[model samples]
Target: MPYQQHTAKKMARPTGNVRWMVVGLCFLGMVINYIDRANLGVALPGMAHDLSLTPFEQGLALSAFFYAYAAFQFFGGGLADKFGPRAMYTFSSLWWGALTAATAFASSMLSLFGVRFLLGAGEAGAYPSCATAVGRWFPKHERALATAIYDNGSRVGGALSLPLVILIVETMGWRESFIITGILGLLFAVLWIKFYRDPRLHPTLNAEELTYIEQGGARPIDPATEEKISWLSLFKFRAVWGLMLGSFSLNFIAYFFITWMPSYLINELHFSLVKVGFVGMLPPLTAVFGGLFGGWLGDHLVRRGVSLSVARKIVICIGMLAGSSIALAVFVPSGAWAMALLCLSYSGIAFCASNSGSLCLDIAPTGRHVAAIMGIQNGSANLAGIIMPVVVGLLVGNENNFSHALMLIGVFGFIGAFSFIVIVGKIAPLTRAKRVKVADAGANNEITH
Candidate 1:
């Protein structure tokens, strides 16, 4: 189906903001997704004592989730692309939710690891589905902000988990915490199934808004005519590698916050459980605004006629550089000073994350492959999730000093900055013509400009 064109004057009339509602759902899904995943980190202290786990064992259990999560990302993306976001989201949410509830039954290290791994597999479909949905619903100029809105859920959920999970763990026990979050996910799946539809099929979306979306570059869902790109073939593109490497580096540092921040507060800084619940929330909470600002700034730049490539790169580089402040925390003497630096570091990570997600949509071969590409990058990035916890666990060691770990995360921030600034080239869709050229030339050669 062809897009309906409308003049600027006609477009000025009320077109409705149904697209915002779609993004709102994406946001809620992400919030639940993070809450389920991050709950373990907060509950780990009590859980470790209850199960008689070593620090290494705790790290192993934490890393276990990423093993399946990273492995399934590509597969999940393909499923999202093939089945549509609505089905993928509903299926993934239900699967993860059930697994989260099942975590309550884990009585041993092996069982906990097994449950967390399955939960990872179920949660892997989330962001890819969100990326696919955003590509189909929002125009280019608005994509970054849309990405930010949903991605902010990670920060929100992470922040909320500190206090919420702590309260649940204190009141009802850690097992009950998992059950409550699990039920929340199950409920969201029902809402998603009932309300989410493609722009073309949405009963409430006005024609004017649809036309505005299409004209501004929102992809209209039409699978019959969509081009199918080979999944393996994506590796031939230099930009794809750049995205993978860049994302991997970013996640290397970011995962430290997800898996170890609470531990760092409790063990290294010697904070009480009550203080951990309140103070631990600061960095991620600050990150929430950083992500929103980054998203808004990127979109604002595009609307002011900045090239997409330049606009995105500038934000990404700045964010990564800012995130390098994590290292500075190690040199600080006071806990307040250390928290300030950590907060800055997390804010910078969130700032870059919004645009990093947008890049998947920006460089996809077509709307059909957005989720697949997202899966590829996210799959690679999540390897950090598997590595960071174990690495931090070892570095913290018997003495429980986190200085080495902080320095390592800070260095990776610089590496991530370099990857985005130097490795990633111009931002544009990789068309079929380019794909065919790479195929003809052999995957050994980089994609032609």
Candidate 2:
């Protein structure tokens, strides 16, 4: 498949590192994405106290976002694939940003749930779009590192939001915190729409950069030439199921801290809000290194002549096994010890998590299907996101003890690892042969040549 589909319009040869600029935008988008999500957890202490929320009610509020987020992943990915990443990303960011700001106006629990649900629906497109864009811009070799840089936004956001959200809530009130985060998203949405483009379509992209991307094997899918793979056909491939189930397991741990960590710090550990802010930042901060390490390791192994498929799987398995330390944290006695253990747990999980994102590109049927693959995995993962908070609420039954929940989370970390090892098999582009194949299908240079 040619990276560029439309060749009628003459274009200038591109110059400079315009592709990295796209990566920068993606990195920023991710930061904004998680900051919006994580801010709620940090501010929940104040918000819950003011609103008189029960533990169950708090869980409901926490999970409500995922309900819509999960539901829309299917829609978001399809839309992004159909409409293009720039438009979908812009709209998704703006909608979520508006909802985050509107959260300031929420007067009751019902109102809050509605706002969060809508926010989830809007943000659903964010990652799929990012994935699709990355598939378009970077080749197989650089993808792990590229994925790490952008996906690190989640950890960085988690790390920074701890202090930033708490400070804003302490000084300006929780409502103001939402508004501030919302504004940040809106600003980034504009920058994304302003600057991002597929390499061939980009005005400023020169021959050097385009050649680098194409040579790297990050070939673009042309809608005009490729047959649409039925959504139902995706399930026949084990990689699809593996990704869905594996992500479900991995995200379980991730959503936990973002939704519950501050509360855990304050209620069980006896940390004040200020203390929670400082203490809670540890795991996510460490995860930044974890993400980098995982990405680098996979790429490094590939450079050392391991097959790409094996390199990715090895990284994922190692990361997941390391993440099982979360289960061990439950046995630790001190808050500081638990924090240290969690730092290890999250680092390992994130290392695997970054590879998982890059792996979607590896296994996509075509560039057009990148967002779709991402959506399937993320949607399945958010099933955990939607269920975990509520499950923890039930297990704890109005107390702060997360022992039962934590154990279940640790189990999932292993499940993610095991699924990747056994079910995913070889990591390569997956598709059934078309009944009526187009000429020169998957030719790799349909337009650029």
Candidate 3:
């Protein structure tokens, strides 16, 4: 389809960085989104004490969110595709924000579990919606950087939550922390609804900017002529399955930080809550740079004439291998050494994550399918979120030793490296075979349709 002609006044040259503005919104949304999710982990100790819950039960609370979250990813992608990112994002943020505040009211395990499950459902749409927006707004060359900018929220939010949530919990109480974060999300939802729009439909976009985006391969709004692929058809590709497995492995290691790291630091290393507030932030803070670097490295490799396949796979493998260092933390003698190893592991996971997200856009068959494919990969990957917390709880039963759990996460990082290297194929859009139809004529003859 041809680029949508701008009837409004044209600029001599592209003047506004509107695309970057969209990326900035996505980044802010991610930051708010993660703060809400990670707040639970940071506040878990106090919550558990208040509720009289055991470690296994605490794991269950964490896992509950991922159950609905995992289930909704594909569906959320479809919604983003059908409804557009602006609406989907607004709805998701509002839904999760309300639920995050409601979490403060939980009186029992069942109530907390129910609230978290619903919170998961509300938050599930965020990443897929952002993926859809990025695929549509940015060119192929800029996607990794754009994705990294937004994806970095996961680390930044996680990093911020350590001290921020701890401070809130320490001063205002855990219940109030939820209320505060939820309000931030609600405010962001308002901002997103007011400011976001499709680039073609954006009033502030200049002709030159639009042309530059189109010429550089930004996917325009879906045209009548574009062929639509069914969501289920995505499963037939081997790369899809490979991405699923690879992401699952990555998340297995990554979720440990989100769900269990605080406990490990406090219970095993004997760090005070105040100490954890300052010290615990280091690993994820390191990851902020790692993700940015990974995005730059992939884009740099492509600019230098490396094959997309070689470039993406190289970064992914290197990240997972570096992440495997988490196991080494168990052998380190001091808390400082252990923190360094964990930082290496978390940073490696963040490095791999930037490109892993880009792979969704890389392999999507069309612009329409970008979010659907993202949902599929993310849906599968988040199963680790559901399983890891419970597994760690069981492994750390009574002893509070995280050695076994650390080794397990390390092993999965190696497995993630293997999946990327061996299971995933060439980094390119998938093609589906066209279907032929037949028409029956009075049960006597059949003709191609």
Best by TM-score: 1
Error of 1 at 45 (Å): 0.4
What is the C-alpha lDDT profile of model 1 across 125-203, one tens digit per residue?
9999999999998888888999999999998899899999999999999999999999989999999999999998999
Residue 199 lDDT (model 1):
91
| Decreasing lDDT order of the candidates | 1, 3, 2
Q: Whose lDDT is greatest here?
A: 1
**Superposition TM-score, candidate 1 onto the true structure:** 0.95
- As a whole number from 0 to 100, the lDDT of residue 142 in candidate 2 is 69
Clashing pairs in 1: none
List, residue by residue over 1-449, the lDDT tens digit for candidate 2.
64332221232334677777888789889898999988888888778889998888888999999999998997788788888889999999999899999999887899999999999999999988888888889767768878888888888888889999888988999999999999998998899999988889999988887876776668487777665677766766667788888999998988887898888778777888888888888999899999998988887787666787789989999899888788776798898898898899999988998788897788777778888878888899899879998998787776678788788889987899988877776776765552112113532211111
Locate the minimum summed-lDDT window of 10 residues in model 1.
Answer: 2-11
Each prediction's TM-score against the native? Answer: 0.95, 0.92, 0.93
Q: Give the winner by lDDT: 1 or 2.
A: 1
Q: Is candidate 1 or candidate 3 better by lDDT?
A: 1
Model 3, 93: alpha-carbon shift in Å? 0.5
Model 3 clash pairs are none
TM-score of candidate 2 on Cα atoms, chains taken together: 0.92
> Which of 1 and 2 is ahead in TM-score?
1
Cα deviation at 280, candidate 2, in Å, is 1.1
